[model samples]
Target: MKKPQKAIVTFTNPTVKERLKPHLYSMMIKPWRMIKNTLMLTGAFVWLLLLLVCLYFYSVLSKVPDLEKVPFQHVREVAVESVQSKIESKTKLKEYQWVGIDNVNRDLLYAIVMSEDGQFFSHKGVNWDALISAIGENIKRRELSYGASTISQQVSKNVYMRSNSKSFSRKLSELFTTRELEKHLSKNEILELYLNVAEFGPDIYGVKHASKYYFGKSPADINAAEGAFLAIMLPSPRKYHYSIFQNKHLAPRHQRKLRRIFSDMLYKEYISPNQYQSYLKWNYFFN
Candidate 1:
């Protein structure tokens, strides 16, 4: 019988090898693809965790009560010490006094409204015109400039939350807290809260305390000139107060600015011209 024919194999054509090479390469890389997928999932989880943390803080800020409802004993003690430390370092001053809201002069409110937020009563939480103007000015000046934060917004910041550096995240948090505050409190209530908690000087926190520290009187007794002076100090109370008392040259300029702001209030029909002129001529003796 004839021997069985030996089995024979043929080589694949070049075209087939090329096509199969890709499939084989993909199979070889399957382990690496799994690792890559795992890493991507881990990254996504970390990002989600950060988002949850931010949301948690935002919720906490929104629910925080007004300054009166907050436990003053917890915050007031710390705030006093913090402010005192700043004053001692900056001005070498030691004396500090705390006064209540009822003792503050009402006239001072008008001055603050005129100087800080001209449209306090009319506008909502944000001042669009002032915000636009501030944005334009900052862009033109190419530097960080003043913003148009409303009294309500300031109250939210000072009482419920700390001031944040300018960033999208911080701004979103501010807006959330501000909206919550607006919903819970009336405009007048917000203003009252602000007056009760605002920092007037290094260690002087609140209108009542500032009144006694500066003018040796209650906030209710502060005259228009005194109100304007205090309003001027709002921008940089520590710096301006020192300048007014220590640097003779700066005192005149600060006085002039205060006069201009007081006059502007009259021009805007917020106060009487007689009142404006009276304050212009009134003598202010800083203590």
Candidate 2:
């Protein structure tokens, strides 16, 4: 018998080898790749649809202006009572006493602006510098140590959203509401809303009510020292307020820190030197 002839396969061109290699790979991997790509595309599409829905609702909600015609003082009362009850129940603490905002000292408002949000008037809805600084601080601390929320953002959160957890969805909602508020309200309006809605204690909402509950006065009537004290209470209402009230050691330090914030506000030109001096000389006697 003749020797068996051996059949050999070879590519005639280098390009053919390259082409065949890809074909072989496709035969092996195409199904998995296709499934992965299809799943990714589906997820992207779903996210886009959800974003559009949120935007649509936001636009519709923005068109509806706040129509509560009652004086802000009345709103302060309601907020105070509501917050007091909630705090008491949530913490199993004593009943938070209600105090109307009408008795609050006006100087306190200036103090708050000076301390918490010095650039409250100039920024539209966000302070990029503060946000950047806060981000940097968080990075350095390896934890959340600061916040960049503008006064308007805070109002949107305090009034409409629950102050419970910081989830992605809650943050998105806050951004949406803040953008809407910026479009519909002026700076002063936003500040007023914040002053009327912010939490001062376990249940105290708004400076007006907070003044009455803490200092036995209205926000408009608070003096510079009192205002500084109140401003000091803003960073962490639950922790600082209780510490200042109950822990004698913390009270002086807290007051001094508040005064420094006030001075910084003046130095930054957020508050006039005249306003700063007025508060500097005012004796802060709570009660």
Best by TM-score: 1
Candidate 1, residues 1-287, lDDT tens digits: the string is 99999989988668987989989999989979999999999999999999999887866566554444445454455444544544544332433554444565556777887777878888777888887898899889987576778887777666555545775456556666677667655676667666756667665666766777778887779876777877777778778667764453346677677877787777777578788878777666533
- What is the RMSD, in Å, between candidate 2 and the native fold over all Cα? 8.7
Cα-based RMSD of the predictions, in order?
6.1, 8.7
Candidate 1 lands at a TM-score of 0.64
* Clash pairs detected, candidate 1: 104-219, 104-220, 105-219, 105-220
Give the poorly placed runs of model 2, Cα more than 4 Å off.
1-105, 250-256, 268-287
* Candidate 1 local Cα displacement, residue 241, angstroms: 1.7
In order of appearance, the predictions have TM-scores of 0.64, 0.63
